[model samples]
Target: MDLSYTDVANRYRRQTLSILADERPLSVSELASRIVAHPSNDATNESTETQVRKARLALYHVHLPKLDESGLVSYTHETGEVTVPEGVADDLAEIAETFRSQMDE
Candidate 1:
């Protein structure tokens, strides 16, 4: 699977991918909170609960499904867990680092 930022350009998706690469097997709510706290997202004045809620909804209804379909992640809705497939975790770490640097620039 091409895990390139070009292929996964959405900021939320990119942040989710980055977080999962480093911290596998995160609960959906926890992952959403991490994504919201990730530096790549512009700081907002919104309450933490609101930010987390929005992130969670997006992950559950959209990003997770797309990433799961692409085989980059394994999301179990019943358990609300998200994990990077081991086969891709190393590659994802490398790719995510590269793109994250570029994003910082």
Candidate 2:
């Protein structure tokens, strides 16, 4: 199957992916909150509850399904947990680490 790099390029999805690079098995609500708090989404800072709700909806309806389909993540709806698959996590973590290092330079 062709990879949907578009899934990774989307703003919410990108933020989700970036976030999961360092953390996984996060509760849906917690993940949504963190996404809202990400630097690029600072506009959400002033509207925490609203952003969290929107992010939760987006995550449940769009982002998580796409990422799960890509085999990059596993979303357990019953448990409300999201986790990066072992195979993909290492690669993404490495990329995230490198990007973080470059930003620090």
Candidate 3:
């Protein structure tokens, strides 16, 4: 199934926030691994390289654009590096915490 950029971004937002909370700067591959290994509360068993690639594309093409538009995060495409904006770290932390809380529920 195909997902809209916004759909993919929203679905993976918590996981992205979690990774950014612990690791400020990350490459796409690093982010993909983190998402696969530590998915959100609603995650399924569809974790694989292909899934990771789709997630990565969604992040780059969909999620990151939204985050950038909101000034919540920034990335350097050439370097494959991403970082949560200074003032948005707390927001990302909250997002991560929400995932943790949901997982515990």
Candidate 4:
């Protein structure tokens, strides 16, 4: 639930926030696909179905719940949907960009 920099600094969480920033109200599975497909995700091959499945599981059971707890995202368990709260997406994108730039350096 910590909304500290370290929380969003996590790769999966950061990616989730950034994706939600642009494409609000995505299902966790869809978010996982985007995360896996993201260019910065060097940890796995984006084209792999196994990788997507793994990412989806991690997002659903770990990242999304944590982000939801932190109030950065709204996650509906039954519907499997995730959304950033109103007016928060731009800020979330900025934070994610900051981290991305730092990591790039």
| CA lDDT of every candidate | 0.84, 0.77, 0.69, 0.80
Report the number of the highest-lDDT candidate.
Answer: 1
Tens-place lDDT digits, model 4, residues 38-102: 87767643457888899999998988888888889999999999998875776887876766676
Alpha carbon lDDT at 45, candidate 1: 93
Q: Write the per-residue lDDT of candidate 1 for residues 10-105, one digit (tens) a residue.
A: 777788777777787899999999988777678789998999999999999998898888888899999999998878888888878876897788
Which one is best on TM-score? 1
lDDT of 4 at 10: 72
Ranking, lDDT, top scorer first: 1, 4, 2, 3
Give the TM-score ranking, best first: 1, 4, 2, 3
Compose the digit string of candidate 3's lDDT tens values, residues 2-105.
22345224646656766688787988778877777763434667657777887789888877767666666687778888898777777667666766776556
TM-score (C-alpha) between model 2 and the true structure? 0.82
Question: lDDT (0-100) at residue 90 of candidate 1?
Answer: 81
lDDT: worst 10-residue window of model 3: 1-10
Q: Which ranges in model 1 have alpha carbons more than 4 Å from their true place?
A: 4-7
Badly placed stretches (over 4 Å) of model 3 are 1-9, 39-47
Flag regions of model 4 displaced more than 4 Å: 43-47, 103-105
Cα lDDT, model 2, residue 83: 88
What root-mean-square deviation over C-alphas does model 4 reach? 2.6
Q: Model 1 misses residue 63 by how many Å?
A: 0.4
